[model samples]
Target: MTSIPPTDFRSFLSSVGRVFAVFFRQGRKARRTRFFFLFSFLPVAVSLVIKFNQVFSGKPGREGGYLFTNLIMLFYLQMIILILALFYGTSVCSEELEGKTLAYLITRPIPKAAIVLGKYAAYMAVMTGMVILGLIFSFFVLNVDRLLDPSLYGLLGRYLGVLILGLMAYGAFFTFLGSSLKRSIFFGLLFSFGWENVIQYFPGSTQRLAIAHYLKSFLPATSSGRFSFLTFRLEPTKPGLALLMLFAIAAAFLALACLFFSKKEYSLED
Candidate 1:
């Protein structure tokens, strides 16, 4: 694409469109796609095995609801969601850099931040679709008996909204790490499973420092002992404030990622 006038709003959008188109098309072939595709089906596999035990005993009980909610939350919120966002988000820039393709993109006439925005949007699209499909299939497998329940669909929608929001907040923050750190996944793990997990247990307002604090506020408090750590000694932020804070966190990290990408001199060697 030729260089459009930098001040032209329509032209800038057109540039973003072109970058988004290129990235979205190629993103499917990424290894994360295949890995997460299997990872998403995990709950389905677990649900089937557990449910089958009940069936083989000729005692198909009402345990599906508890099993579904428990397994899904444990797998996705505690594990898959964070890992998905970590790998894909940090790879936003790192992938191109390691592949030595960043030069080709930077050489284009488009604004550098447009590269970040376009690629971020494209990755989000791919990740969201994959995770949701997994969530849906697992939901169906676990809750096949309740398919017609009106409230079940509403509950599904709530889970979808929360997962997507978590992806955005976590993905953007890790994208910043990708832009700034060569070994971002290490720190991503530390932050996601360590600080984010541990900080929520701290008393008073100090728990608010972790991103999980805001995301967990949107989820219902569970009574299960396994996940009591999530709700134990926690202060819930209002949903409105939590939503706003998540958006703010995403925006701030994304902005910094863009800024650093635009200013820093990255080399194929580095």
Candidate 2:
């Protein structure tokens, strides 16, 4: 049974803690969880294929850094991160609405913001765990020979940091949309696949409007060294600016999501 806590700072924290644990355990049994676990390892398959092909051609060497930057990073930053954020992030509220459980949720004594905050934190933990495990295994497959190199670990650390920031920003933005918009999934697809992909490649400062632009700023290089022109970045945002902008985006969206969730009324029929 759900705990009924009075609205206060301590009660709010208690609400968030309880909901976090409950939702986290629920998420484990979710089909989305299984999908993410499987999706995370997809890159490992590609890594093996590439490694075998390189070895057969007599061009194999410990080029994990280059391979990651040129090939795998694109698969990750452009595709995997976006998919994860969109699928899981938007589900925070959408799932409740679809399951017809939001009514029961809001009627409880717990603060509404706590529901959003708790669920967001729970999803973050799940996404992070899946992403970290998948990315680490993928990196291992790519850099099998360089596991002892200290620099390799640093590279992995930087990559993880950048990707996590991407998840946080994208996830929060989608969570806000999910709570506010009726057709958030449609808009999310447009935003993720349409706006993000195209805007980053646009000419001039217009490209700066894209979240991908800021993300690419922190990436050491573009998609592929040879075909880098495909996803070129003429003037990437500064690392400091990227950090600021991403954090600001996440915080702003989360605040909006919480506010909207707290105030908006939903009917059982709607």
Candidate 3:
């Protein structure tokens, strides 16, 4: 049996810290890093349209309110988080490769896992920050009158938690694709809109295979449209099971990413 090296918490923490610094500096220097702006502001643009439509069409009272609020959650997941995660997540390793810095990082004493994880941590920071900001913006735009209501805060908290979980799950999967495949973004797009969106709508147990399926299961059933884009009823999974599945998906993909990044021979030409 291979003997594992003794664990050192201090060393691990130091490596993580170093990786964070490098990725953040790289992010700052990357001129094309408009993802932050695009992700942060796109929700505002959408909310403006929705707000106006709601004003003209009249308020969706009570149950309509539930559908509208939950639709925002679904829209945020499908549109904002899905696109942002695909673009940025798939760029985690590819960006380094493009800059020709990945080779240098590999040669250093830092563990490859640490580097992969560090980059993921940095990605999480930026993605989560933008998502939270977008959520707040959308909330205010759509619910300006309800903003001061104390009950809305609790609902916001729940939605934010689910959004973050969805981000982490999708982020890890796309990050893995970036590390493992040459043309990750193209495939990621196909999988996001093509596979995930389509599969989740399929009736019966097959829908459970998609990450979005589990996410939808976490939505409160107070609204008829909480988990469905159409009139088709959604199969509900236990909240605990859904949450567990999300964490599992995130952990599984992240592990694959680390393993692939540590072993692969990446070309710097891209």
* Top-TM-score structure, candidate number: 1
Clashes of 1: 0
lDDT of 1 by residue, 75-120 (tens): 8888888998998899888888898989889888999888987888
Candidate 3 has a TM-score of 0.86
Model 3 C-alpha lDDT per residue in residues 1-270, reported as the tens digit of each score = 875455766687789789988787766455545656575677677777877777788975433235346566766877778887887788888777876878788889898888888888787777787788877787778777677778777877888888898889999999999999988999999999999888887898988888888877766664343354632456877889999999999999999999999899887763
- The best-first sequence of candidates by TM-score reads 1, 2, 3
Better of 2 and 3 by TM-score: 2
**Alpha-carbon local distance difference test for all models:** 0.84, 0.83, 0.78
Error of 2 at 164 (Å): 0.6
lDDT of 2 at 120: 87
lDDT of 2 by residue, 4-31 (tens): 5555678789999988998898887788
Candidate 3 off by > 4 Å: 1-9, 28-32, 49-71, 222-231
How far residue 148's Cα lies from its native spot in candidate 3, in Å, is 3.3
TM-score per prediction, in order, is 0.92, 0.91, 0.86
